[model samples]
Target: MTASERMKMAAGEWYTCIDDELEALRVTARDAVFEHNSLPPRQRGNIAPALRTLLGAMGEGARIEAPFHCAYGFNLFLGEGVFLNAGCTILDTAPVRIGKGTLLGPNVQIYCAEHHREATGRLAGLEIAKAVTIGDNAWIGGSAVILAGVSIGEGAIVGAGAVVTRDVPANTTVIGNPARAVTPR
Candidate 1:
């Protein structure tokens, strides 16, 4: 089997080769972060190598604050000049790709892993994995919950407390329970 296939097989139940590598990288990255105790400081993402592996371009002037949570980091990709503020959470069961110049407001939860509900009982721990993608220049407002297989198009804004179920188009502002586009800008 291919490396990716092996990783997929071992995502929830067991650990794959990629999973170990990602964990190591997260630990190293977390240790490298400086000035974590200070306030209002220019902060970068406090990545824990033991947590996961991060892919993509996290550019200069980007900041990802503390208490950020995620699954295997290898399935995640962050873009340049992106700011993931405090309390950001990502469950990257599949791949969670974030676009460039995006701003993630505080307490944003991006989850790609989904569970199946059966009549008798719930399926095993994790049912299946899906990918989540947020396009370029997008802004995810605070406390927004992005579910699996959802894509937020480029230049779109997801307002706070929104539960995004479908794909959001580019250059639009979406809010509410199901997250509808409010206006085009």
Candidate 2:
């Protein structure tokens, strides 16, 4: 039998995002996100209940500030002491793993889907999923955008407003558009 769209997506193959099953998953994520975002701060401790249930895995002490959003919550995995500040958005079309003690500043965006380059394919909603992994103790600054298939090494620092398009090496500091590694002055 042919693979379903979800299966194709999970396998990192090209698939149409407009499928009924995908829409259902998105609706589920939306509901969970709404619940997480709507609850009072006192009531939503660390990770909100609904969102905690929706995620694939969440380690102890993982905290997400309110107003966080994800396209599909099930593909997100967070390790211990992971802290995400307010207004973070993750397009988790593929697996997104944030390692232990990692911190994401406000408005950090993680995208795991790359849309087709062709205009006709874009019109058809064709896209391929790619996993994003942020290593332990890494710091992603505010307003940074991490593209699909990027693996951020442990202890790396991503400067504010940086657009990360390539893999970052361990303990490296990256800044500016396309995220080139920077040496200390």
Candidate 3:
């Protein structure tokens, strides 16, 4: 199978693919520490380099935290000032795009692949990947799981520990497990 096919196959069984992409991504990400991380500590602490490396993995102007994990580095894209706190993980089998100035708190997970539990296509390993986009200036609180095809609009605030399954409009706050709009203010 080709690389893309391998990624499709690795969706449910995520161990090997995530491991495979990590080394190459780390290599590309290592030197970026000098470019983005080698800044004064007083400004934003050590997160700058991490962001720089992640951006490097995705290409230019894609700032991301170093310690973050993804299924495929190339499938994930980051924007300016995208702060991903410690323990951020992205399953980017499809695509995960985080807009500029978005703040992702600790333990935030973004996933793009959805699997079928029924034993229908077990041999072929077919699964669908839906893109997830977080618009500019959105704040995702700690431990939130953003599922596939969900878009969080600009300036939206997602409550801590919320499991987002759908779209959230701009300038709104969402809470609870399924993540519904709590207020429009």
Candidate 4:
């Protein structure tokens, strides 16, 4: 028997995002996210419980500010001491894993979904996905966008408003669009 679209997606293979099962997962995530975002910020204590139900795996001390958005919360994994500021968005068509002690600034966007280069394929609702991994102790600045299949190494820093299209080396600082590494003086 052929595997379902959801199964292929979970395996990090190319699959159509418009599958009914995937749609149902998105709907479930949307409902959870809506409920999470509705909670008053003053009630800080309530956030974790909601996230625990939404996310696939959340380690101790993981905190995401309200108004977070994701295509499917079940595909996101947060490690211990991870902190995500307000207005974060994750398009987790595939798995998105954040390591311990990572910090994401406000308005950061992480995408694990990609479309085919050919317009015809995209028009047919065909899509591909790659897992995104942010290593331990990394810091992603505000408004940074992490594209599909990129891995930010341990202790790496991504400057504000940068667009990362490639893997970031460990302990390096990357800035600007396409995210080139900063030369040490």
Best candidate according to lDDT = 2
Indicate the residue-level lDDT of 109 in model 3. Answer: 93
In candidate 4, how many Å is residue 102 off?
A: 0.9
lDDT of the candidates, in the order given: 0.71, 0.97, 0.69, 0.89
User: Ranking under TM-score, best-scoring first?
Assistant: 2, 4, 1, 3
Give the winner by TM-score: 3 or 4.
4
Going through the candidates in the order shown, the clash numbers are 11, 0, 4, 0
- How many pairs in model 3 have backbone atoms within 3 A of each other, for residues 3 or more apart or on separate chains, i.e. clashes? 4
lDDT of 4 by residue, 1-185 (tens): 99899988888777887789989988988888887788777765435455568798988888888878999988899999999999999999888999999999999999888887898889877778899999999999999999999999999999999999999999999999989999755
Candidate 4's displacement at residue 23, Å, is 0.5
Output the number of the TM-score-best candidate: 2
Report the candidate with higher lDDT, 1 versus 3: 1
Model 1 worst lDDT run, 10 consecutive residues: 32-41
User: How do the residues 30-93 of candidate 2 rate in per-residue lDDT, one tens digit apiece?
Assistant: 9999989999999999878989999999999999999999999999999999999999999999
Better of 1 and 2 by lDDT: 2
Q: Order the candidates by lDDT, highest first — what do you get?
A: 2, 4, 1, 3
The C-alpha RMSD of each candidate to the native structure, in angstroms, is 5.1, 0.6, 5.6, 1.4
> Cα lDDT of model 3 overall?
0.69
Local accuracy of candidate 1 as per-residue lDDT tens digits, 1-185? 55543365335432232345655654644443322423234432343333323443455555577756665556678877777888888777677888889999999999876665553323233245678999999999999999988999999999999999999998889999999989654
